[model samples]
Target chain A: MASNKEDVKLLGMVESPFVSRVDIALKLKGVEYKYEVENLQNKSEFLLKYNPVYKKVPVLVHNGKPISESLVILEYIDETWKQNPILPSDPYKRALARFWSKFIDDKIINAARKALYTHDEKEREKGVEEIEEALHLFENELKGKFFGGDEIGIVDITAVLIAYWLPIIQEAFGAKLFTSDKFPKLYNWSQDFNNHPIVKETLPPRETLMAYYKGHYERHVASNK
Target chain B: MASNKEDVKLLGMVESPFVSRVDIALKLKGVEYKYEVENLQNKSEFLLKYNPVYKKVPVLVHNGKPISESLVILEYIDETWKQNPILPSDPYKRALARFWSKFIDDKIINAARKALYTHDEKEREKGVEEIEEALHLFENELKGKFFGGDEIGIVDITAVLIAYWLPIIQEAFGAKLFTSDKFPKLYNWSQDFNNHPIVKETLPPRETLMAYYKGHYERHVASNK
Candidate 1:
């Protein structure tokens, strides 16, 4: 492993929520590193070398070694930094944290995309239901101020996209599923998550995300037509 | 945490490749525990209480605490029983092991199912192509006699189902994909993985698996008709 701490760098796209998860974790842990935005359409050779399997971004290079998958990278960060620990100390608690983090990434992200992108009524309804069911489970899981505890931890970091990007997607798709009354706990949690110091500073602006997504949706519709 | 090691109980089904993964881990770690096969069609309250989220089997219950998700449970077992480490000691290597493990579960499992079960010709072809691609990737990642280097670690455990069940499914479906010439590494790796002493002893017999899958496919086909 390379010894220089300054060698730590992140390769990602600007508007990617997955990249935003890594960005918030780094800022929260107070780790300083260089950020290089790769043109996802024309991926750089460095990015390809770092993550050949997925060919996706949000690859965290520490000590000249690459760690892909945002959840995996987050755990690595927590283990390496050992400051403002995102994962819990107990082994069982850590497992639970990892479970919920995977839950968000595996279930919510894809469901939300289907809900927004699928034009078919039946498929769109199924997507909406999946998102609602997952969020409901999360709402029940949250008993303290955050998913982890009184402070933000791994699960909250995994939920960056849900808190920040979901509203933009809802507006673009004209679907209002996350009403405050129906999911009061989750609604409140999203507000708290977005307001967190590091998260607020680092999360992409809503307008920027909205413009980017609107264009994406328009392009998708045009292509389909 | 449970003080008594004997309190470790695994709730699973006999034919489930996932359940076999936990069994292999327990046997390798030399952690003695009771294995209860659940009736998946009629899930027991114990299984439901332990894994309320996904409502699936292979729930590892230690003392009274329950950990779901086979990969999460594998990590937990590794942490709990340090005798035989299934994951790499270095954090970076551990991350790569997990990356491949997740790749296999998220990509290979679903693709293999689609390839075997889907009736649509185009979709089935796509699934076959996906399985071929993913297996090739696994083939390349293999080195030093095992994916985890000279020892059966997390990735090998994750590939348990693929090694044991894929051929059964292929035979039942009348499809041949993993030719020895086309995928020499993967083909050899499967043989090595299946022949591991603990795995060999614990893995469900091929005849049993074939009968179980034959019934499953018959039911699926009849329902679709």
Candidate 2:
């Protein structure tokens, strides 16, 4: 690993899976950086200035230049730091990785969010069905131990939500969508991914995440009533 | 330009701006390839097979390996054929380009689509407002002759819809959202973009697209009534 001297700062909310994705990427690359926790409810001026468009977390500021959006930031990190490359080297394989990463973002995460967060019963049911169908398609793409073969690549990093947050949200809300039996490959992959030393170290404590999601579930139920 | 020997096939619909984005990228790269039209309403089995996840057009098949999504295809083309690079050489600039490209897809295009296609009056009004807001932010990003600083890069290519199709759709639907006076920079960029030789040659004929969108507008109105 290359010794880093560049000034890198991550503006993030600790509980965000998106933030964790950036954190994990930095850890994987062995890049040293400053971490600033942003209170999402009351976003800091620095966060807003860095990411004026979205005003969202997981904004990676490198040498004073800010890059928002976790996936975009991941690509930036991969391109900037050549060590422990996250994406495949081949152009075609890289394209495939980008495709699946996008699928996880556009379809799987969106559906999962709806399933866990939406107040409408019908929409939640539709979200559950949609997530199941999307997961099956994603499951078919998993031919190896990790989406990046033996190593956790961009697709696996992008799918941090599936490995860590989804189960917590599912359990917190008492939603029964993703299961070991229903998606054995994905389940196994998730277990392997979560158990990875880097991932295990980088991820927030399970009990903290559980309490956070459980609070969200409680609030959701209260509002729905 | 490197002499092309690889078999490249693009399965696309004539009227789609997304497909046109890929077409223009290939043309810019000077890559000779086969074009296979797919009727979206009655999709070809080949397209379904290649892009089973999305089942959408603009699937670039390079040496029998399929890559779907226009932006993904654009990056693949840039990487595969290094002749005329579409993205920036620098990582931060590339991230900025990716960010704007995504903003175009996620915010501007979605709002433009809803404004042009939605049957609901309230939704259409909201879409119009949203697109105007989104376009203003995009306009601020324009500091050079083109988004690529003299060449039409990925961000400009991704904004093909805003350039070639939006005017036609606006006219066809008799909606007034994107205007030169309101968004002079974006409007100028659109004009410069559409007037480019490759873009002009690759885009579907004006009359054909106008008629197509007009038909859609008529049907939308009829259905609402």
Predicted structure with the largest DockQ when compared to the true one: 2
- Candidate 2: the clashing residue pairs are none
Please give, as one word, the docking class of candidate 2. Answer: high
lDDT for each residue of candidate 1 in B17-48, tens digit (9 for 90 to 100): 88888999999998889898899889999988
Off by over 4 Å in 2: A1-4, B1-4
Model 2 over residues B1-225: C-alpha lDDT tens digits?
A: 545568989999889989999999999999999999999889999999999999998999998999998889999999999988999999999999999999998899889888878878899889999999999999999999999998999999999988888888899999888889998889999999999998888988899998889999889889887
Stretches off by above 4 angstroms in model 1 are A1-5, B1-6
Candidate with the greatest TM-score versus the true structure? 2
Fnat for each model = 0.78, 0.97
The candidate maximizing lDDT is 2
Taken over the whole model, the C-alpha lDDT of each candidate is 0.86, 0.92
lDDT of 2 at B61: 97
lDDT of 2 by residue, A59-173 (tens): 9999899999998999999999999999999999999999999998899988998988898889988999999999999999999999999999999998999988888889999
